[model samples]
Structure formats: C-alpha cells, structure tokens
Target: MSDPPKGPRVILEDDQPQIAPRLDFGWDQAVVPVVPPNPPSRWSGFGRAAAGVVVLGLGLGALEAANFTAAQFTRGAVQGWLTLGVVVAGFGLIASAGWAELRGLLSIRAVDRARAAFARGDLEAARSEALRWAGGMAEAAPLQPALRQVGSIAELRALLEAGPLAGLETQANALGRAAAVQAFAVTAISPSPGLDALVFAWRGVRLVRQVAALHGLRPGLAGTVALLRRTVFDAAAVAATDIAVDAAARALLSNKLLEQFAGEAAAGALAARRMLRLARVAAEACRITPPR
Candidate 1:
C-alpha cells in the first residue's frame, strides 16, 4: 500500500517584518526641539550704516589729531560747518542703528516666548501675548483696521475650532490675504527704511502666531519644520523682496526709498497664502476644537 501522503514539510523561514530605525529629525516627536534664532547678518543695512559711521568718526578723529596745534580743536574752528555737520550726523546714524538692532532683538524674544507658552499648553497666555503684540499698531489711527484684523484672529480660531469646515478654507484664504495687504499698506507709509523693515518683521511674526493659534499648535520643532518647508517653496519671492528692500534702502536717504514695492508686495502675498495652508494643515490634524 502506498505510504500516507507526508504532511507538507515545515518551512522554518524567519518571516518577521523588519522595522525601520527611528530618525531624530524632530518630526513626529511629542517634544519640539528648540533651535536658537540666527544672529542678524553683517550685510544687513543697519549693520553697514553703523560700520560706515564708525569708520567716518575714526577718520575724522585722526585728521583732527594730526592737525592739532597748541589751541584746542573746537567743533566750529576745526574744519567748517560741513565737518561739524558730518560728525553730528554720524552720531545720529549710529544711535539709530543701535536702536533698530535692539528692537529687532526684543521682537525675536517676544515671539519665542509666545511660542513657548503655546507649546506648554498655555493657550490663554499665548493669546494674551499675541494681543499685546498686536496692540502696538493701535497707536496709529490708520492702522486700527489692521490691528482689529490681528485681534480678530481669536474669533477665527474659535470659528476654526467650532464652525463647519465647508467654507472655512475660503475664510482662511480671504483673511490671510487681507492681513498681508494690510501689512503692505502699513509698511508703505513707514517714515524710514529702518521702520519699514521693522514693521515687516513684526507683521510676519504676528501672522505666524495667528496661524499657529488657529490650529492650537505651538512653536516647536514640528512647526518650525512646517515653516521651513513653506519658506522653501516661496524662497525666490522672499529673496527678491529682501534684495529689493535692501537695494532701495541703500540707494537713497529719503523716506520714499522702496522703489521696488511691487516685489515686496508679491512676497507678502505669497507669505499670506502659505500661512493659510499652514492653518489648514493644523486644523485637519487636530480634528477637534482646542481648549478655550
């Protein structure tokens, strides 16, 4: 009789699925790694102005010392009114440059604190800081609307959390675009290039804060990654704006230095669009309304 059919040979191959190694890129992590902000570039307009003033002052001092006689060198008697005027102007420019740099540093710190607050789950603190930041523009009567728009972001956050998602995207798009345009208007009326750049930086910070608030997200490595990604996509526009603004500032000493306003405007528009996209992603990810 034929032997009973042998059972299928036991195949002992290792069938365990391989797992991929974890990457520490900061994405998909619960804790966001904080990266320090880069120091301002030496090529910045303010830096150059400060440097030039220093050189001018040193050159004037050397010339005065070399021509020194028994009599003390008085401002009026040293050279002429032009020399005295140059000395006074150099001091003023240096002071202004220092002040601008200080303000920029302060602004960066304020933004960092706000981000940290949100990351720690203190939404109220985050909102308060943002509102305070927006309040800065309330001093100018013309900027009241922009201030209101900035303040109204809280309402949008509420709506984003509770309202239907059907038309929310449209609302986000419109609001973001409007805010950017308002920023442009405010910058256009700035009294100086220093002030224009200051306003621009503050508005960008506010926009980022507003968008972060909308999704109940905070400043963390993940958010930073998102921002970097958005920036990459719009780098050309942003770079063009920087070049235009710098060239304009360096070209003239007048208030109407931004001859290439169109490029700056385009940059603002692109930034706003990116902010809207960011809010959308955050809202979709969270799925539920954030804590009040």
Candidate 2:
C-alpha cells in the first residue's frame, strides 16, 4: 500500500501557493523630520524692555558677585576668614545662582501679574498694564499702546500715522476710523435710560471695544496662525449675530406682549437687555473686525 501511494500527485491550479511578503527596510527615507518654524515671541514693548533689563542685569551680576565676595574676604577677621574660606567661597556660588534666579523671577513677577490678568482675558487689567507700561516710555507723540488706551477720537486720528507700533502700521489705519465710526454712532443715537443703566452699558461697551480693538475680525499674518484667528472671528461673528438676533427679537416680542397684558415696565427692562446685546456686537465689530 505504501509503494502504491508513492506515485506523484498532480498540483491543482486552484490551490493556494506558498508566499512571503517582502519586508521594507525604509533605508531610503530622509534622515531629518520636516517641521515648520516656530512663531516669534510676542512680548509688549515694555515687556521687551524689561527682558533687556534682566539680560543687562546678568552681566552686572557676574562682576557684582565677585566684587561682593572680594569685599567679604577683605574684612580681616577669623569669622571673616571662615566666611571667605567656607561660607563665602561655597556659599557665594550658591547665593549668586540663587540671586540670578530670584532676579529673573522678580523681574517677571513685577510686571507679570498684570500680563497674567490679561491672559485670563481681562481687558481692563491689560489696558491698565499697557497704559502704566507706556507711561514709563519717553514722550514721543504717544506709542501704539498709549494711543490704544486713551485713543479718544482725537488721538486715534493724529498719532496713528506712525510711531513705535509701526508693526501694525498699514492701511489698517482705516481700523481706527472704523472704531471711531462706531463710537460716533453710539454718541449720536444717545440711548438714554438713566444714569445707572447708562454707566453699565457704557463701561461694558468700553470693555468690549478694548477687546475688539486688540482682536479684530482679521487673522494674523500668514504662518502666523492668522487664518485660524480669522476663522475664530468668523465663527464668533456668525454665532454672535445668531444669538443677538434671537435675543433681541425675543426680547422685543416678549416685551410687546408683556406690556399689553402683564406689565409695561417689564417691556422696558427687556428692551434694555436687548440693547446691551446689540451694543456688545457693535462694540466687538467696531474694535476687531471692520465691516468688510
């Protein structure tokens, strides 16, 4: 039976063949990974000045540490000798490193509190910090930060042509006029309710305007993530319009019905609410995105 089975069997065309995948070593791939360049840091002028001051301080520190150590060595006492030999020599290095670290921290801390507030999205705090920072600069027809802060209709037109803020210097000068137009429109409309409500709306708008001015509907430069910023602005504009319209219409309609039946006073309150909503939209648009 074994002998008979030894006869060759025919291979079937439909049978699966033995196979192995060729492995890729990937030796031909480029050695270096491609990565885009990082964006430049955006510190304020005063912040940059402060940064420079810290750097200058480092130079002074080296000489300062040595001089201070030398003075300690010259005191000429057993205690002084130990202070120089043990405490001064080893401790001096420790103290020097510690001092430089502390200075860095203090330098940042001195101004950083306000900047931190700005980061937390407080325009008032940022504006105050900006103005205070500007006050320290030499008077030269007001820098951008200064113009941005006290930028009443007058200063915006005059000092805006050129100055330190020349980075933003462009036909965007039209932005200043746009903001002024919004301001003027408000002034002309004169939405008088009373002293209390008036103050709240005014302050709210001012805060809104400050935020808008700094963050316009426009994005930043190319590769600056400007497009992303503009996308955010577009989203905000669309969302804001949708919200404002809904709120305003509802408020107006609710007030009309409420006054007709329930209470007339309720109508005015709702109207004020609607007015503020519109004002926020107007303020944000005025400051950030000019009507295109």
Candidate 3:
C-alpha cells in the first residue's frame, strides 16, 4: 500500500545550518500583499484654505456694506483698507487650523498603508511605514495613542528572520552566544525512544516560532505562540539526546516574556504570562544548564 500524501515534507532539501537564523534578510515580497491605506492628498489643505478665503472675504464684505448702508454713509478708503485686512486675517486663522487637521489625515493614511503591508507579508514595507505611524504619536499631542503595536511586531519579526544571530532570545536581544553544545538527530539509529520524542517536540517548537514570527502576531495571538514555543522546548529538553539544544531554545523563548508585556489594553497578557512561565518550568526536567 502507498503512504498517505499528508505525511511530512521537507521545506528545504538543502541541509543548511551554517547559515543560521536570518535576522537581516529583507522581507519576502512574494508573501501575500497587504492593501495599504490611502495617503491623504496635500491638496486637501489647499482646498480648505481656498474655502476659508472665499467665506471670510464674503463675510467681511457683507459686514462692511451693512455698516455703511445702515448709517447712510460711505466709509473712507482708509476704513475700507482696514476692513479688507481684518477679513484676510480671519481667513489666515481658518487656513492654519485646517492645515493642522490635514497633517492628522495624512498620518492616518500612512498607518493604514503600514498595516496593509504587514498583512501582505511584506515585512520590510510594513516596518518602514510602522515607524512613520509611531512618529504620529510624537507629532500628535492628542492625549491618545491611536496606532496599534501591530507595526512594532512586524518590525521585530522581520529583524529576527534576517538569519543572523549573536546572543540569545531570552535576553530581550538580537543575539546569543552558544550556551552549550550537544549531539542529537532524528534517525532510527538513536539509542532511546525518549530521544525521538524529544527531537520531534524540539523541532515542533522551532516550527511554531518560525510560523508565529512570520505572521507578526498581535498581543492577543502572541500567547498562543508563547505556549507553543515553551511547550515544545520543554518536551525537547527532556526527551532529546542533547540537553544543550533544549536548554538554549528554552532560555531563549523564556526571555522574550511575551506574556509580561500584556498592557492595560492587553486582553490576554496575564493568561499568556502564566502559561509561558509554567511551560518554561516544565522544561526544567530537561535542563542540562548548570545552576544559575
């Protein structure tokens, strides 16, 4: 009988590990494209200014006629000039206010564009626009932070995917030195059944991280990723032949503390935090690291 097609498939035929994880790799534009939000036209401010000028001019003209005609007297050229200046001044004030609002509109457009890029899996584009939106907060003393952290997540994920590393993940950093070393594999030649199980789980956790980071999950979904990362590493640590690999992945995943970042608006931060912590501890049984 033939085996089912639903079985395992190798994503990459080449056994390339010397390359390491990509941290600086540019985003894959081939990934789905996100529809960017419309950018506000600079012309909007001009339109508002034009409208204000017309209205102010008309209003001031009417006032001048009313004052002169009601008193049955024509004002001198000096008075006429004074009235014209006042009308122009009023129009200027209105134009300035409209320009301010126009800035806000343009900013919102940038944010929308950023969000769209992220959805499309264009991480580079998303990160670029996200930084712009974040600057909106600085420009707007609006007493509110309207933009979501979705952009920030996208930027972070893109950085991690660049395929370069130095330190460790748990350190809230971009690199990690080798904490230890171990020899392990998934071949049938392995000595222990427990080792097979551990290898499978360890690989599984790495898969989860790869997928999660690829998607740029929001805080709501981050917990689920955390759950998977911690769980797989824990299992791998205990069941694998190499304790170092398990310990290192565990240390790295734990350091991110995605749960701890649950903010006042974080709906599931607490739950994620608790679950991630418990899962990391479960990895304790697999620990090969010396007491810290």
Highest lDDT against the true fold, candidate: 1
Give the TM-score of each candidate: 0.31, 0.22, 0.26
> Which candidate should be chosen as best, given TM-score against the real structure?
1
Number of clashing residue pairs in every model?
0, 6, 20
Ranking by TM-score: 1, 3, 2
Report the C-alpha lDDT of model 3 over 1-292, residue by residue, as the tens digit: 9877996787763787866775754566645356697897566888999989988886886687557544442456677666666656876776766665564344334434655565556655755554443343332222123323334554444432231111122321111011111112232334565774565445444433432232222112334344454455554444453344435544555544643342211322222232343333423211111112
* Preferred candidate (lDDT higher): 1 or 2: 1
Alpha carbon lDDT at 249, candidate 3: 46
TM-score of candidate 2 versus the correct structure, residues matched by position = 0.22
Can you tell me which runs of candidate 3 are displaced by over 4 Å?
1-77, 136-292
- lDDT per residue for candidate 2 within 3-87, as digits (tens), equals 5677689975556556645667786575444568888878999999988997777657656756665676677556456645764
Considering only N, C-alpha and C atoms within 3 Å, which residue pairs clash in candidate 2?
A: 212-287, 212-288, 216-288, 217-288, 217-289, 220-226
Name the lDDT of candidate 3: 0.41
- Which parts of model 1 are misplaced by more than 4 Å? 1-82, 138-230, 233-292
- In model 3, which range of ten residues has the least summed lDDT? 174-183
